[model samples]
Target: QGVKVSGKTVTIGAATTHYDVSTDEKLRKACPALAHMASLIGDPAVRHRGTIGGSIANNDPAADYPAALLALGATIITNKREIAADKFFKGLFETALKEGEIITAVSFTAPAKAAYQKFRNPASRYAIVGVFVTKGKDGVRAAVTGAGEDGVFRSKEIEAALAKNFDAAALGGLKVPAKGLMSDIHASADYRANLIAVMAKRAVAAANA
Candidate 1:
């Protein structure tokens, strides 16, 4: 599902990312990983019909939506009520959406600085540690996807560091806890935890650039 702001339109599709028309760069800037993943969502035919809303509502852990949505502090407009991005995503492939509540639209406030850094597995291209950073009205937010087995989560360590210094040097001494990080064939929990710091630093560097 995808919603158009100016025309107040919402559409659903089986494919992902919705590439038939050009996406707003400002929106892309709000969530860079989504912008990057849009190209890989599917082939030309699929790109023509895929929708970001559908993927987000679906909440695929490996998908790119959760990180961007959370980092950008997007608002999920549903039939029942509006939910903040932080509260919208509940777990792997789950959301706050009720049985009959459908997403009407999603709106994100543009950020002054933002970037997405991902360490993709070679075969699947899924992020091992996807970090999305944003400096917005609410301050800095760091969202991590693919590192947590439970689902996407905010990286408070990185956020606190960035909030204090807003630079790569700020992240130099911070350590991301490995407690709940994901581990599998491609990487161990320690590796993913390390990648979180590396990606966060990269994201900060990119944002500053």
Candidate 2:
């Protein structure tokens, strides 16, 4: 998912306070997860108003962009330097952005195959448990969002399973441990852990289909 700020079209510079990357035809084709996740952000208004840069920069625990960025191995470009997605996210509502540095755009190389599945909070449309899976030249990557207490994180277990065989059946009987997951009024940590496995399976299935 790449973020470029412009008035009405995609560009490298900033003029408009916000730009909708979700509707970009090229982006939709390159990374379906970007379009899918963006469409699921709140409702129509939020989708149109929220910028991709704004969402990733905020790094909300339940935010969708972070998971996509991590799964796709995107690069976060700033005024000062570029940061890898794995290193960009620091913690809950935190990032590696330095003072006076602004995120100009993000560059993501679309995976050979990828899909995202989310169990969302009905009212807010935010993911209570979201999983993004990608299988490409680098390998298989499984990233979970809205479930980590620290924020989005990669699931090694799911990734390992997918690496062996990129199919939903390969993940059968495998589970992500509940440790370090978020437990709140919405869903418990253990429940989120379960959702991670289920969502990952669905994501793999979708990618294969």
Candidate 3:
């Protein structure tokens, strides 16, 4: 029904639906950015029907969950074993999941401050470029989705800047260069690179707010 956050970690069952994640009071308190991201996915109807695990297992390059999970340093538990988020995602619509292995749940250590910012594609409502940022025991981690040619990826430059100063101003001069980023009909690699920086700045602002 709802997600589970035990100790410093949060877990969402594979069957747990998106609407539940978006509305679960405990989950909201534990990780507001995750809940807020759930709320922003598609519309009410879509949110009602989508499952977090489904989105995660699909590993869509533009999907929201991958960015958040990666940035949060989450673990994906499956029928076989547990996989770290960093190792879970392989590429666009690809994952470390084997032929029969099923994702049971995803767990993450809740960050002290975290936020997600997305530039949506008008019709699809999918992220043209999305950024997820977190500051916690692991320090600051920044993950970018929808722009990477290889799927979701961590931005070391952004993380380094935010790790030093967790403020939007710290990232003002920094840039996510347009290399190895995807170029699609909706957005060019250069445009997505720019979006990455802007979204990172906005995400930092949102985390502070």
Candidate 4:
């Protein structure tokens, strides 16, 4: 597993483990939100064994990487070609990888300000609701995970609000409709919708902090 940096763009080997991603000095500097998100995934054992590519390849609905990757506009590098994050995730436990396609690395230009926040399940530690927000060349992006029925997705409302004012308070009184969100024993669609807003606000706060 390796991480390479060229100017503001950073490329991380697909085999790199969550632990490595969480602690790599270069990655931490280049993508603090990603590193912090990695740090919050699973337990120590899982962090040491779970690879970033494997996680994204699995495309688990509750996985954290997709939120940060999507919000950061990361490129998924595969043996066949590169895929944009927006086009990568298909749905629950699905991705754009083809039969013979293999992921090699994931790359992104570090954003100016970003952070991720998740409300997690106590046992498995998967996100019940997660949000990652960034303000950079893309202006502002807010990606939500663990709530959408179609998996990770951008919140246009949150993005528009942040574009107007990139602050946690800017999201005040914001509401995310529960129509397309998931409902489980842990949380209802309405509950996750509330979490989406709460987590987005927290993520913006962390980015500013």
Quantify all predictions' global Cα lDDT against the true fold.
Answer: 0.75, 0.82, 0.92, 0.93
Candidate 2 or 1, higher lDDT: 2
lDDT of 2 by residue, 1-209 (tens): 34443332223222112235656666566666667767777887776567777888899999988998899887888889989999999999999998898988777677888999999999998999999999878999888999998999999999888887999999998878999999999999999889998999899999999
Regions of candidate 1 where Cα sits further than 4 Å from its true position: 1-37, 40-46
Estimate the overall C-alpha local distance difference test score of candidate 1. 0.75
Q: Candidate 2: what lDDT?
A: 0.82
Question: Against the true structure, what is every candidate's RMSD?
Answer: 3.7, 3.9, 0.9, 0.7
Clashing pairs in 3: none
Could you estimate the TM-score for every candidate?
0.84, 0.91, 0.98, 0.98
lDDT of 1 at 203: 86
- Per TM-score, the best of the predicted structures is 4
User: Model 2: runs farther than 4 Å from truth?
Assistant: 1-19
Best by lDDT: 4
Cα error, candidate 4, residue 65 (Å): 0.6
What is the alpha-carbon lDDT for the whole of candidate 4?
Answer: 0.93
Q: Model 2 — which ten-residue stretch has the worst lDDT?
A: 8-17
Each prediction's total of clashing residue pairs, residues at least 3 apart in sequence or on different chains, is: 4, 0, 0, 0
